[model samples]
Structures are given as structure tokens and as C-alpha cells.
Target: MATSTPYSAPLDNEKFLYKLVIQLLIFCQGSHRLLEPHLLAIGAKLRSGANSQELLSELQAVSKTLVHISKQAKQDVNVGEGDGAALQNNYLLERLDELLNDAEVPLRFQHQTSLLKQRVRANLSEDSYKKVIDSAITLLLNIKDYSVSEQKGIDVFLGDLSDRLDELGQDVEIAGQANREMIDNRENLNTEIHRQVGSLKDSTQAAEELDILKNQTAEYLDRLLEQLLEHKQIEDERQRDAQEKIELMTKKLQELETETETLRVKLKIEHDKALSDSLTGLPNRLAYNNRAEMELKRWKRYRAPLSLIIWDIDFFKRINDTYGHKSGDKTLALVAQLLLNNCRETDFVARYGGEEFVMLMPNTHAFQALEMAENTRKMIQSCGFNSNGENVNLTISCGISDFNESDLHDDVFVRADQALYQSKQNGRNRCTVFAA
Candidate 1:
């Protein structure tokens, strides 16, 4: 007899699981469909080649993050519908906010985006979030895509380079052909002289006949000399032409090489600019990510003390709202200067986003980072920012976290961010360290 099967048999459980998975998948698909318009509208903003690449990269990251959240929610079957949805949407919007950061966006769109970011962070319903998303898309659509023109400039440079290379190759080929022609001319001249000499014989003859032969021989010798002279002149002319061609090619090649180098340097400068925050003149989020990864690797390999400090200007939005963006910018610049002044040579400081700044401290533990952060905070607090003829005292909130062997760089960052959130919650102007 077959063993009695339990009510929750493996097949039955599998069937239930399959249905649940399907439902989750359907829900995710439907949700993506709903947001597709917003995504497309945002994509429309990235019409320029220069901005499109970074924007698309961020979009891809955000999409992956959303997918991950959706899958995680799918696994947790017990999560309530409203709570799960709100959680997923909140996380999605937050991740998007980070990905579609205003600091990274074009300057023309920054003002609109800065305001949108505030609304995105506000306590709003999912519907309100959707409205904010739509507004963001609309604003992005209105901005002109300048990257297209920038890309055209790059194309023109590349085209000129290619044309120069082709001209150089042709010049080289012509010079070689000219050289070979000169060599062949000399060889032919030598062969003709040799044949003319070999034709003479040593035999006794009458004086008159011998004189006639001498005359003929003299005439032939004169003709040969003239021919040799003509060949020499031709060869000289060819050689001169070839030398000139070679010299021209060399000069052109040098010019092309110099131009290529200039273009490369220009591209590098542009890349650096793209990775930098214009307002603060500090390395931006993209640069921070790269450096953070490298620092994390070093810590993992060497077991060195690595600490992260995240700080934000206290009431920065208020500063913006009160004194105008220019004043806000001045304040940010002041804070950036303070941070740079306080940091050690080994410490890497970067503008993480909007008002936030990050410092990666190698060979420093959490306590050390905390001390450094406190100093920075105090210095910023004491700095008097005279913005729009108003005296503004600035302060910052900081969060400090240290690296663990088991944690990824992102893990460490999340912990630091959490500590920052706690600091903000406790009060705006203080430093907090991650406990766990």
C-alpha cells in the first residue's frame, strides 16, 4: 500500500507556490506597464548623446533595483497588500531619486528637479508620487538636449583625424614609389655604361680606321656621359621631390599626433567635468562610487581600518528657500571648502548628492572618522556665510560607519546612510555612529 499522503503534499504545495509566483509576476508586469509612460517621458529628456548614456545607465540600475524589490516582496507571502505595495513603491521612488539625482542632471533641469526631489521625499500617497513622477517627466521633456551637438563635435574631430591619417598614408606610399624609381634609374644607367664598354675590342688595325673607331668611341662616350648626366639630374629631382614629400608627411603627422593628443586631453577634461559637481567643484556621486569600490577592495585585502562619513548641510533646503539658489550654492561651496580643509591627504572627500558629502577614510576607524566628522561639523557651523547680505550660520549632520570584512561597500554605505537618518531624526546638527 502507498503511504498516506499529507493534505499539504509536495505536489499541492508546489501548485500553490506556482500560482503565487504567477500572481506576483503578473502584478509586477502590470505595475511596470503603468509606469512605462513615465519612463518613456524621462527617456525623452535624454535626447542628447552626452546625457543619454549616463541617464540610461541610471535607469537600468533603477529598473534592476525595482525588480529586486518586487521579487523580495513576492517571497514574503505574509506581507499585507497595502504595506507591501507602499513599501515597494517607496523603495522604488527612493532608489529612482538616487539614480535620477539632480546633481548629475544637466544644469538647465536642476532647478525643476530640485523642487521635484523635495516632493518625492515628502510624505505623499502613491498617487501623489505618480504625479511628481509625471511632472518630472514633463520638465525633462521641455529641456533641450545639448549632448547631440556635443556628440557632433566629437564626430567632426574623429572625421578630421581619419582624413589626416589617409593623407599621411598616401604621402608615405608616394614617397616610397619615388624612392624606388630613383633606384631603378641608377641601375639602368650603370647597365648601359657596362654594355658600351664591353663592346670595345683590342685588335691591330690601320691608323685611319683606328682613328674612325676612336671618334665613334668618343661620340658614344659623350652620348653616354650626357645620358648619365640627364639620369643623374632626373634622379636628383626625384630624390628632392621624395624628400619634400617625406618632410611634409612628417610635419603633418606631427600635427595630427599633437591634435590627437589635444583631443584626448580635452575628452579627459570633459569626462572629469561630467563626474564632478559643478556647484561644489567636488567629485560627484559617480566618482565617489568608483573610489569607494577601490577603497573597499583595499580594506578587504589588507584588513585595514576603513571608515565612511556621510554628512549633509542642516536645513539646506531651508537655506535654498530663504536666500535663493545662488546663496544656497555659496553655502554649499563654503561647506565643501571646510570639508576639504579638514580632511587628511589620504582621506577622499566627495559631494555625494545635493547637500550631502561623503568622506572615505582609509586607515581610520569609526572613532577616528567620528572625530574628523565632528571637527568638520563644527568648522562648518562656525563659518559665517554672508548670503544675499544676510548672515547665515551653517551646521551639518554626520553619520560614521566602519567597514567589516563580511560587508560589501554598498552594505557599509547603507549602514552609514542609516546612521545619518538616525542623526536627522534625533536632531539636525550632530554626528551619529552606526551601532551594528
Candidate 2:
């Protein structure tokens, strides 16, 4: 008999089909125009177990429309493109772009896109409206080859694979049953032998019968004792084999645990490295971006105060030119340490890029933030570094901007940057607050 391999199912074919369709639609959004909301609408219906044929027909119509609009879009515009027809068409296209962009987020999709689409239909000329619908349909139909041909192949493969797995599972079950039956037979034989030995012992209690059968009984008893000794030796060997297997498994488990710990430590180190500035040992720009966004959200929710401070080393390029890059690096690191030491735990400081750093101060107003920046500037000016036995001193300029009701995360940073430019313009080593 041939041995069969054990099998487990991969992803279900139906589930895979649905996911593939969704991915195709998402991909189309980047390449094609006006397809996202229509695809999204179809996707919603498909998931609700709606009729596939009906949905496919709807998609086909949309695909045709998309192809028509795309062809029109690809045509060269006339030299005098500011014609009323062109302007109206461009305005319509802009709104459609917004609809598809907003449809990327699922929760905001229906309400935003539906309302926008309605507004667009009301404002657009009849010809422009037709073009939009046609363009959307064409983009969706482009996936027909994947959804139809490839999907059929996958379904057949999964069906055949599932059948083979069922057959193998049945074979394993039957073999297990046969092994159990053999063990049961052996147990029954042992019980019969015990019963016969007990009967013979009872017969031996009669003296005349004992004398007649003594030699035969002694021969039979010796053979039985020898058989019992062989069985005991077999059991002893089995126990030794089991003990070896247990020891091997225990050693393997310990090895696995050690490997897991090593991997965990390596992962943690990599995670920290990704977010850290190697030279200054401060959070890098990428880390700063994430922290600022979260802080902005918190400020918006509670209407609490938030402020940003931007810092730059005064005449940093001149220092790098005079002392070489290594000395410049030492100065940057020194300034980073000074700011870190002066800030509270709640504040976040990050190296924004080359000789520049940003501090995000929560619950700090404009004036308060300026005070902190001034203190940092004074400390940096007084701080000295011993680089190659040369006493090196550093000074920094800072800019402060506080969060307001109208402020976005980027707005706060931009204002602080403008103030920093002003400080650099006025003099080298002073803090400047943003005027607006």
C-alpha cells in the first residue's frame, strides 16, 4: 500500500475571490479615474450575498462607460483650452477626483461620495456627466480577465485539493481503527491464559491427580514462566525507548525558548534604531512626525494648549568649515544634550535634520514656550566641549509658536520655522517668538 501525506486546507476559494476583487479595485484607484465609489458600491452589494450575475452586469455597464471617458481624456486639448466647454469639463473632473480620493477611507465613503456625486450631477452639463459615468465603468471592466478567468482556475484547484485531503483523512482513520483492533485481540488472549492458569492451580490441590500430572504440570509451568520473562524484557526495552524520546523533546523545547528570546531582543533593538537619530541620540524626524500628530489630536479633542520650538546652531556651517565635520558633530551632540536636560519628561525633543531640532511642548503657551527656548539657548551658549584638547563653546537660536484653534499640526511647525528664520536674521544666538 502507498503512504499518503497529511493535508490541511489553505484559504477558502470564495474568501480569496472576494479579497482579490477588493485589491484590484484599490489598485485601479491609483491608475484610473472615477472608479473607486462605483467599485465600492459593488463591493458592498457583493458582500451582502447579492446576485453575482446582476452585479457583473452592472459592473460591465460601468466598465464600458469608463473606456469611453478614458479615450476622451487621452485626446489632446485644443491650444485655446480655456473655452467654456473645457472649463466646465475640468470643474466636473475635479469633483470626481475628490469623490474617488475620499472613497479610499471606508467609513467616510458612502456619506461623502454620495452627497458629492449628487451635487456634481446637478451642476455638470449633460455631456460631461455622461463622460464621468462612462470613465468609471471602463476602469471596472478592466478587471474582467482576473475575476473571471483566474477565479475559475482557482476554484477548480481548491475543489480537487479538498477532495484529495478528504480521502487521505479517511485512510488515516481506518488505519487507526485496525491498530486498535489488534491491541484488543492481544488483551483478550492474555485474559484467557490467566483463566487457564488459575484452573490448573485449583486442580493441583487434589493429591492423587497431582501425582499423576506433576511432571507435566512442572514442564508447563516452566514454559509459562519463560514466556512471562521474555514479555517483561520487551516491556523494559519499550520503557527505555520512551524515556529517550522524552529527553530529546525536552532538550528541543529549551533550544526553541533560547532562540525565541534572542529574536525578541534583536527585534526590540531594530525598532529603537528605526526611530532614533544615530548621531545625537534623540528621536529622529520620522518619530517626531508621529508624536506631533498624536499630540495635535489630543490638543484638538480637549482644547488644551500645545506649542512648538524650532532650534538651529548659530553659524553651524562656519563651524563645520573651521573645525572640520567631526568637531561640528560634537557641537551638535552637545546642543542636543543641553536641550534634553532642560526639558520635562512630558516634552518631546527631536533632531529635525542637520544642526536643527524641534521641541513639542504640551500645555505650554507662546510666552512660556519662548521662556523655555531662551533658557535652552543660554545653557547651550555656556556649555563647552573638549574636542581634541580644544575648548569649544556653542550657541543656538530658537523660534517659538503656540497652537491656536485654527492651527493644524503643520501650521504650528511652519510658524515656528518662520520665527526661527527671523531669529537668524536679527542676530545669531537669540530666541524669537512668531508674530502671527
Candidate 3:
């Protein structure tokens, strides 16, 4: 494939990528930039199309989640749907973590996104969302590098993602299933109630017949009083038996509920921390490794397209050296903030270490990753530093690499690191794809 665009114009693949991304974001139904970092990490390791598709589907799912949440939120009328609010909030955290996340994404962006999510949640209308989606499509169609083939590819990707979204769209199917189950249970309950009522009616009729017989037995007055006493005793025994049955059902129900609660809490804790990058609020190392492993396995199984990017701060030691540790810390934080700001929710951004950032992009190829790496490189270059009252200009060198099942994360790292070294040698503040 040709790497360069037409001579007269500069092609922006990132913008091209984002146009679809924006539309998909809108398509995700107003879920608010919720993305999963682990999926990108996994995409890097894809050795099969199946794995790549799986990761792509995951990314698509994030978009679907946004829509689902938006619809659910608009439907929520109560002032405080406590648990609902928490779930929505958790979803928001997970979603925002994807887009506005990095080892050093700015506090300002975080603040802005946090505020916007709240507002968006408050009154997200389909019409407003439609406007955003229309604009997103327009912006995408206008990009200079958007060739017919590229545009077609994007549309195809969108189709695939849409298909996956549609598959997930049946998320309501589970609810419907539960409702059906409830209906069945109601039917069973009604049947049991009727059976009990029938039995009670039969018993009542038998008692009434006995009472009439006794009332007509004037010659056997003693026998009539004795039968009435026996009837009262039978009623007491029936009430006692009914109470015992209720107690047994209550105990069994409570036990089952406690067990379910325990399992849910345990599962949720593992899931929440597993995919999170605590220090930077990006995807954690565990998530990255697991995702990469999963994607690689999938790639090996299905032969799908995938790629990786390793970009770190240039001369990071000097920043710590010249600016002191606090400034260094600030710089790292700032850089993390930058990565978070620039990336899509589906893009994974994690701090590799003291001054390095890595991204795992599943649906994108090497060239696209390179373009993105360049944009990041330039952004960091232009992103002048800030401390008490001083300003410092900075630059970053980046490296790009693609991978497969035969390729280990370590090998990919080596290639990208070498590429990064080349970028540095070539004069920092640029991107280099692995030549070897």
C-alpha cells in the first residue's frame, strides 16, 4: 500500500480515524467517551482476525454501553436512583477513563469531562445527539487524507462495529428473559394459590355440612357440642402448618440471596481493579498484559490485523534533573494528561514507567499508529511545561511497531524501543516506525 498521500496535500489519518470515532461515539448513544484500555492492549497482541475482531467488538461494546446508559438515564425519573446513579456513575468513570485518561492527562480536561458527563447525563436528548452525530460525519468526510478506499474501509469497520453493536443491542433481551421468568413464576404462584384456595373451599364445605348435620341433631346435643370443638382444633393446626411453610421459604430465599451477593461483590472488585491504572488513571499493567495476551491468542486463532505504539517522553531524566522531582512529577502528570486528551475511548493509554507511555490499537494498522504517534510527538513538543511561574518547552521521540502471535510483548517492546532510539538519534520530537 502507498504510505504517502498526494503531493499537494497533507493527509491526516488521525482526523480520518477520529471522524468515524466521533460518529461511533455519538452512535454509542451518548454514553460519554467510555472506553476500555485493556482492549487496545489486547489488540497489540492479536495473532488472529478472530482476536482482532473480538477486541473490535469490545470497543464497539463500549460505545453501545454509552447508548444504553443514556437511554436508561433519560428514563430514570426519580431524584435519586441511588443504585442506578452509582451504576451510571461507575459507567461514567469507566467510560471517561478511556478518552480522558493517560499517565498525565491534564486536571483541566478531567474537570471539563467530569462536568460535561454530568450535564450530558442530566438531559441527553436524541435530537441533540443527532446533531453531534451529523457534525461528526461531516467532519470525517471532509478530512484531506480520506481516500475512497480509506473511507470505504472506515465505513466497513463501522459496519462491523455496528453489527456487533446490534448483537449487543439485545442487551434488553436478558431483561426480557428475566421478565419472562418472573411471568412464569407468577403463573406458578397463581396455580399454587388456586390449589390452596380449592383445598380450603373443600374443607370449608365439609365443615359446613358437618355443622348442619350437628345443628339438626337435637336428640344428640352432647355430640353436637363435641363436633364443634373438634372443628376449632383442626383450624388451629392448619394455621400452624401454614406459618411453618412460610418460615421455611423465607429462610431458603435469604440464604440464596446472601450467596449471590457475596459472589457479585467478589467478581466486581476483581473486574474493577484489573483493568485500571491507578497512578495515572489509565489502564493498569495487568490489564495491558492480559489484553495483549488475549488479543494475541485471538490473532493466532483468526489472523486479524493489529498494531502497537510505544512512545515515551524524551530526555525525561533532564526534566527531573533541571526542574526537580516535583517538576518532573508535574511533567509526567502533564504528559499523561496529554495522552488522555488526545486518544479515543477505545485507544489504550498506559504509563510504561517513570516517563514512557504505550498504546495498543486493535483496528488500526502500522501506518495509522505511526500517524497517531507523530501527532502525539508534536503535541508533547508544543506542550510547553509549567511550574510555579516558569515555562519550559519540551519534545518527545516516539517509536511504532506491529505484531502477531510469534511476536511477544517483549519483542514488540524491543522493536519500538529501537525505533524510539532512532527517533531520538534523528533529532527528538519525531516518530519512527520499526525498520528492522
Q: CA lDDT, every prediction?
A: 0.78, 0.71, 0.62
Candidate 1 error regions (>4 Å): 1-144, 194-220, 247-262, 297-304, 321-326, 386-391
Candidate 1 vs 2: which has more TM-score: 1
Using TM-score as the measure, what is the rank order of every candidate, best first?
A: 1, 2, 3
lDDT of 3 by residue, 261-369 (tens): 7656855764665466545666666677877787777667777666777777878767755765457656777788888898777777777655677887777777888
Clashing pairs in 2: 62-137, 63-137, 63-138, 65-134, 65-135, 66-134, 66-135, 66-138, 67-138
TM-score, per-candidate, Cα-based: 0.62, 0.45, 0.44
Measured over all alpha carbons after superposition, the RMSD of each candidate to the real structure, in angstroms, is 21.4, 31.7, 35.7
Q: How do all the candidates rank in terms of lDDT, highest first?
A: 1, 2, 3
Please give the RMSD of candidate 3 to the true structure: 35.7
Estimate, for each residue in 18-111, the C-alpha lDDT of model 2 and write its tens digit: 6766776767665645666677777788878765455676578668868876777756344345476667675656546443422222222335
User: Residue-wise lDDT of candidate 1 within 1-436, one digit each (tens)?
Assistant: 2565664477686556445534544455546554455355444544443243355554565567688767876867656876788888877776656555534566566787778767866677867978987886776555434556667888998998898899988888888888788778889988988876665432223335867788767877887889989998998888789888988988998998898899899888778878888778889888999998898888888999999999888898688667765677688788988899999999999998778899999999999888888877887788876765779878899888999869998888899999999999998899999997
